[model samples]
Target: MKNLILLLVTLLFIAGCTSNKTEFKISNNGVEAQVLQLKNHQISYTVKKDGHVIIDTSLIGIVVNEKSLGSNSKIRLSERFSEEFDYSMFGGKNTAYHKTNISKFEIKEKDGFTWFLEFLVSAEGVAYRYIVPGTGTQDVKGELSSFRFPNNTKVWYFERNNDWKLKSHAGEWLCSDISQMPAISKMGPVQGLTLTCEMPAGGYALVAEAALYNYSGMRLEAIGDNTFKANFAEGEKGFEIEGDILTPWRCILLADDLNSLVNNTLVPSLNPKPDGRLFADMSWIKPGKAAWYWWSGKFSTFEAEKRTVDNAEKLGFEYTMVDEGWERWSNKWETITELCNYAKNKNVGIFLWKHSNQLNFPENGYALMAGFLDSLKQTGAVGVKVDFMNGETKSLIDFDEALLKLAAERKLMVNFHGCQQSSGEYRTYPNEVSREGIRGVELNNMKEGPLSASHNAALPFTRYVTGHADYTPLAFTAPGETTWAHQLATLVCYYSPFQCIAENPEYLLKTQKIQPAINFINEVPSVWDETFVLPQSKIGELAILARRKGNDWYLGVLSAGEKKQLQVNCNFLKEGNYSAEIFSDDILAEPVPLEGLNPRANLTKRNTAIPFKKEVIICDKNNNLMLNIAANGGAVIWFKAREK
Candidate 1:
């Protein structure tokens, strides 16, 4: 009887051990994540950094046909492969990009079907996606994709608006202790949020959707317990999985510091590589500045618009963007063609704008979108800015994809305005040179008044981490609430390959007081080979960056705080002599009245926006220089390699 009882106990122990099955792991750049098979045969994962658990086991599954397809899933087969690749960029934070390992687990459901869960371990972070096989069309009811944070984890996110048409993607970023993350909105579902976490154990992680093609844009809904579930927009829960589909990647961008976070390549790396063959001469898809007319809010005629193009020539700007209302001009088509020809003579390109709704088919009888793109190309205009596409439903994503392919064939560059947050799809379509996803300079003129000083300082650590934005950095805002030096620094702070500056020629070119910084602005390029975030930088307080272009390094320092002396270290430079040109505020120089300024700016009471002092200093890589920056002001320092 005793032997029989012992045997029964041993048998029960064996069964329990089997239920706690082994897990698979993939690691890169000091970050590791474990995929666990739970007792219920469902899939779950835990993330670790430096062998410390940052994210405890979290659920990972999908609901299909109104049922939980993964509830009874068993890992039937597992495979792992690692590879590395490199490519050059036409325009990006990095001139060259590298991507590196992927693991695949085949989960067999109770229905005798197998689907895949794929993970790509990257240097900056980890990304995972679902691949549903044998699919004619699978009614994907919902997903169990969720992120569970460790105790005391913090996150910075924009409280997303339910009405996406109101430029929902653009908003001032806010931070919260995940434990106390607010439940916002009338429905109180915590909808439209994307969590970018500041891990408790150090380092950072931004939860974002990547390579989103043919999939509905996602938002994270707070479900309590310091967790957020991946969910679709309202009425977009039914995800149609047509054919063998690779669902968009749910990515976590990890970094150890502000510099690493700003330099994370997780987003674009998940996207398919660009097909260089799209254009006969890819050089035409270059990176440079543009003269934009609409920001002035002045009644611009054909002659005024043409003068903007002429300013492009004078300023060495590669393009001149003509915003809305251009179509209302008499003989619109022919008149635009004439303007295009005029710009082409001066070696400047023209970019025309059109409301995204007008570009759609059927009702507009535009019949063929290709015809419109072709006409623009014939007129010698180099690009088009598609605006007001404020939503990201499946059909709209398809429209964006189709439009990019069409524009590529016609050799016309494209900029998506008032759009959704970038999923790094630009890697697949380089023609998409710029996009507006952040609450940029336009907000600086809203009835609410200029974007807060903190908002500008904090952007690099938040929004710009995913991709560059068409902030249209305004040099014209000096003398108002922000210093001219601060406005000038944005050229380095915000990057848009098709960099459109929100100012007419006079303010930028002929303004006497602004000339000191204008010359350097003209010389600055819109792309960078390397970037370094200085130690003094703080979120919503100060921003100091050193970005390299060829042999020169541009240092931009923006302060949202009071006047104080700050030091700069040229540690990023090589061990050799260098020339540093410093441009900072001249506080005593009189203020000017606001013109060409939107009423939202409300600078009824303003200061001298253009007064600046320029000084040159000789330095080496080891030198530390002090700068006296004013409240709501900034400075720019250019380091040229004298040794080289």
Candidate 2:
């Protein structure tokens, strides 16, 4: 009896050990993920938590292509293989976060490539790992985290650096480092979390995010083994029945280049500006002229339209943009034709606004869309501002490319609104002139003072680093707009080849307070030969940028919320006597000695530091002159140097 009992105990112990062992592996495509019993690879277990089956690996990574469905929903799970690792962090206490045991690992394909590999932990946080083979360079580096929120939720969140802040408007968005969050909105109760980053050459890793969703009563709980899987309700039976409960998900794309980024996001094609085409033939469009538009407001009445166009030309603007609300009948032909003729008679080019779908005629059949493009050409419209294509899906991307092609064919300049951040598209599509991606002058009209200023400063290093942004600079406030100084500095702060100074042209011509900046903007070309972000040490407190437009180089320095000083260097300039025009806030009321202004001073030997909150100093760079800028303000300096 004793021997039999001992044998029974041993058998039970063996069974417990076998049950506790778990095995996880990558699917054949390198993206579909499967969990198997340790002893037998064929014996697979579906993703489950607390005894509830979540997703089956068999159905997780299926690829579906459709126009009606947005790009955010498509899932592709493929293997990512990398040989090296490159990682860096900013604003956090620890900068270098590397992984052990992950010198190499396989990225399992589980419902939409939403799987995480637990790697080494650091003081900063845990580093989740994924591998993308043959799709990366010698080394791989990408952003570490992304944030997701439910629809209709509003929150104020700050990053580690605190240089940027977030005030979201009823949609999903992502923030990196200590930067302000871009406001995003889409039609539908569902909100999405989207992030795009360039991987290092020849190496790739899994992109991961730690998410927190605020629901009324339920406590925050771990829904699945992997955060990516838990956040996304893939193959869940009862998810649709749960009304009003916001389901938040995380998505990461394994991309080899910018093209892959576009392709993975399901954007069919990109609008690329042709190289040096504008330089060859911009005389017809009148380059270096001021422009204005009445946007997001009433401009339908014939009398109102006539007055606005007349006022725009009279105020020294060479062009007028008639934004939305004009397409009341969905027929753009008659309205655009009339507006273009009216603006042409007034000697101002008319920029008409239309939605991308309407302009491209996506739903009306392809041939009919072609006819509409032909009509736009006949209407004599100088340009068209297409808006509301915020998706990165293939159809939307293809539509963007088609619109650019149509515009080019018709000789019409284009401005893209509600766009993802610029990705050097202007390089190929010169006619695709400007894009509204930054938090610019519009925020001043919607929100209060200086928030726009703070966000604008943060953009140069982040969004503008990618390419030109049509920030719609220079709004002169009679009572409630941007400060006069802020308006003056925007020309230098925001970098766009096609800069739109949106305001009542009459107001600008009469006040003439913003002329200096306007003149500077006109003289400067949209394309830059080279660019650099000045090192200020502090993040949001101040930012300095320098860009070259020919033999002449323009440098702009801006401060946000606080007074800061920067040391200027003239090493970037070829040795020569060049004039530097400095613009700043009134320094007289607040006395502070400006530093690093001397690259080279002249017989004008102006130690002359003007004491105004906002001031412009024109100095010759023959003698080193240090530029002193004020808080909540900026300085624009132009220097002409000999070619190296």
Candidate 3:
């Protein structure tokens, strides 16, 4: 037994030498704490008894430089703590570059056992204050900041006072006076707070925290010692890209307490099974006949709503979308209920509009709107169009999931707007019918011209690769629109089972030119068995995609701003004759020949070059087939391969 004790002591001595060590000092009647710095970014502490705590206040400095202009434009400072901390930018209004005054920091005692760290940035004149509760020994807190997005300057750039203002590129970390005020919102003040800023040169972010430790019977493990929460105000300005503008507030939170932190800010909550039929059961979504209208203006008046519904049914459109504006003014649950019943009586499913604020219900507001969702179910609404979400924090994430679950339970579908990239959430919650994350055709109606073929071509590779994006396809020759041929090509190039024709039902019937495309749209299913990003022979100028549902294969190719020839191949198919139907440049043609088709066919055996000037084609291997495409155009092909 003595020898065993000696061996255990030896092991303890060796472990002590290898482990990292951190030290802390307590003040303010054994509540406030200060941690000694470590050589590396990581720090560790051990308390001999209960009610001990440690506080960390490490700040990271980021320097941003413009690659195109060879200039260093801004510096961002950030930090994190154990409890909540106060933070603000000091010089947001200053347009002139001031080398002498950049940023200042300070830490001091406030109330019992509590300490305050104040951060002041020069360009924005914003001040941030943090209040950290003091614990005995085991409690932990810290701060960190980093540089991101040096390649693009315009992403975070905003115009101030008609002059281009910038942030400092170099600064030092200092401990100074704590004079910054606590953060406040239009609603009210917040607790457990942190502050962040974006400089002119590129992107930058920071975070901090504070907490308490040494009370009797305060079990650190029971408090879920691994987790912590940080809250910040959501940005109010809308996001602007190139010349287009969109409104959605966004914020980011960082933490060393990985388990304690939940990234819920700005995430959408949508589910697949909405208490009724699965998405696959929506047979009305085939490609043939669909239409869209800006829901708010069109549906606000009874006469207009009756006209839209009657006209849509008369034109034989399978579906119609009620865009934004419906939910903007109607705060009562009865408003939605009435609208839903009216739409149902007209034989059209209503797609209601909702903003992130409506979903959150703002603290105590959830109770007043508690019956809003129940009304949607009672009204027979098909789906809700949700938009303007701009954060990814834990509470928001939880809310997102809750909304999806609630919508599912109520049997209503969902379409998310103002979202980050899709993260396979739709697969889990299939009732999350669609999302808008890419630059789509709406931009053409609002600001810039319609989305270019290049933009459409780039999507299947970058954004669409993530999952479903409602691109609102096929607007034929509206005043500022692309050609009819280009519009037809999008039905195939863009992937969405619940696609929008983006034209009036009356217009569609009058033209009668879009009948074939509408037929195809109605026939296609929303979910696919497989999707492939074909290797493009060219970059930025062209892209091709192939998808399958059941036994049918669909292929789409898009070209941007240029004419080109492509050697189409069937290498992905079996060595057998397949029937194909092609749609290109407003013309629907019969199947054509794809000869010498095999798994190993090379450039020599498969030498057919399809001429394209923004066009699409569909062909079978039994006969030679060719179709012409318009400038800035695309093509869609449906084929049936014989069994091996």
Candidate 4:
């Protein structure tokens, strides 16, 4: 009788412990996630795709004012609701995400704060954020969000803004055991803000942040074995905000293949919609190629400025950017107005450059910018490129947003250089065109070798996935271990709304040798309506991309320093015949061994040009195109749909 009583007591104890914890299941399509609301304000979640666990119950919470929300703290759910909606984007992959599910819960903390927890699951990935209510202003101490994956996961980590160690974004995408992962450091060897994980359980996951406004950018620091914690910029003590605070959305892009990572719209979807009035008449905002004087060793002289404008007209470019030296005149308006009139006469717009510090004065800062821009608008200046904002502090982030709005009000376009990567800002402010966050072609002056064909191959999947990267491609001075065809393909491979032509105008436009390649660059569009990934594209090896603008299709293939052959079937075309124009590496052209050498030696004067040759093929029901790319070479095909 005593043994039976003890057995009943043990069974009752197991039931009590289980009842304290509650599990919530949310799913969309093939991806499903389960979140557990545990005792003491602690929470955990596990994400699965097609019944295979991708994220294994990772801890998620925040730390505020020295109080730990992920640890021992009493809390209770006040309300729960689920919402579904679809919204349009001004500039993104598509019109909408089709369907989105938002699950929200209001939890009241016993210690005087109420937190609104939200989990948003979509076809692309899962996102979540925390909103603390009832506040005039508050300082967030830190965040307690973490990702604890299963053992033996592989990751493609790009060290963020570590120009000190990793020059020109050149480093290994180290694939190693998750347990051996090192913590991310701000000023040490190399650390990353973006973590792309190849899960051990049959799928892929990308850990990144979205909707970064009025908050410091987030980077992952490995805290333990197979675990990473959220770390913000170190100069500030968390974010300072007014009224109720809605933090940036932390997203996990889960997918089965590389193509999804390129096409996922989660980051832009998290951002607020564009101000309808700002975009109601977007005809003023034009995205096109421009000529720049910086890379050509030209300064603020009439001859240099006129040279760039002449080249802009020669190459059929839409704008010419006068870099920093234009500000040398004490009466800046005189030189700027004269140059603007010169560019206007040549039918090319003007883009000016400014230092961030020169525009930071409290009294005359914004007012001076307004007056300066107002004067330039009369001379037909279209945009301005602001540079040297080196950190992601709250003040800087807010300043960036303010500048975009101010530029928009003045009917001027904006591009941020030396700034953080695009966090869907273009969606909110359509006037904001491009940013130079990635290590771009300009780094060739400082580093060598790694910034070659392999680096170009990795960008479309890693950096371009974030947003518009102002790489300022198409350099004719030094091709850098790549053929002219490979450089031509970069015009199509790298997507920038505001692309700058970093070539010498005298060499690229005046020379007759490369006019065939230059002719194609003159016609390529800066933005696309649709994009497709081709097969056998491996990072650091090769990149094949297909993009659509209007009714035409453009295919670009970039190859590293290895002879390769690929047979491409035109089956992706509509059920009709098409005409294909192929620009590939000339097998018969002299193989110039230019790798690891000073790039300036190969330049030609205005009279001498190196000509290139390509083939034209007609694709029908019975044709499969064969591409033979040489070492450090590339190919591009322009296909036009034809009637049968």
Worst 10 residues of 3 by lDDT: 215-224
Q: What is the lDDT of residue 456 in candidate 3?
A: 59
Name the weakest run of 10 consecutive residues (lDDT summed) in model 4. 602-611
Q: After superposition on all CA atoms, how large is the RMSD of candidate 3?
A: 19.9
Tens-place lDDT per residue, model 1, 366-420, is 4477788988888889999999877776667777887888899888899998788
Question: How many residue pairs collide in each prediction?
Answer: 5, 58, 86, 1
Candidate 2, residues 375-414: lDDT per residue as tens digits? Answer: 7668877777778765433345456666766667667777
lDDT of 3 by residue, 286-316 (tens): 3222356661134454345456666666655
Error of 2 at 500 (Å): 1.5
Candidate 2 stretches with Cα past 4 Å from truth are: 1-290, 295-318, 327-348, 357-365, 393-395, 423-430, 447-450, 478-483, 515-518, 587-628, 640-644
lDDT values of the candidates?
0.75, 0.41, 0.39, 0.70
lDDT-based ranking, best first? 1, 4, 2, 3
Q: After superposition, how far is residue 177 of candidate 4 from its true place, in Å?
A: 4.3
Top candidate (lDDT)? 1
Error (Å) of candidate 1 at residue 535 is 2.0
Name the better of 1 and 3 by TM-score.
1
Each candidate structure's TM-score, on Cα atoms with residue i matched to residue i, is 0.91, 0.55, 0.51, 0.88
Global local distance difference test of model 4: 0.70
- After superposition on all CA atoms, what RMSD does each candidate show versus the true structure? 6.5, 14.9, 19.9, 7.1
Q: What is the full ranking by TM-score, best candidate first?
A: 1, 4, 2, 3
Comparing 2 with 3 on TM-score, the higher-scoring candidate is: 2
lDDT of 4 by residue, 1-644 (tens): 43234223323322232333767777888878776766534566677778876776566667665555544434344444544445543332435463567777665556655677788777788888887764677667667676767788886665434463222233334345677676443544224445677777755787877888877776666655466666666523566677766778888887776677777777776788778876677787888889887875745665788888998998899998888788786567877788888888888988999888767543655677666667767766889998887766667777788788778877888988877666777778878878877767765444432256777887777667757778888754566567777777888888777888877666776656566767678888888877777767876678888777776678888788687898776655556667788888787766544333234333331211122467777785356789888777788888877865
Q: How well does candidate 4 match the true structure in TM-score terms? A: 0.88
> How many clashing pairs does model 4 include?
1
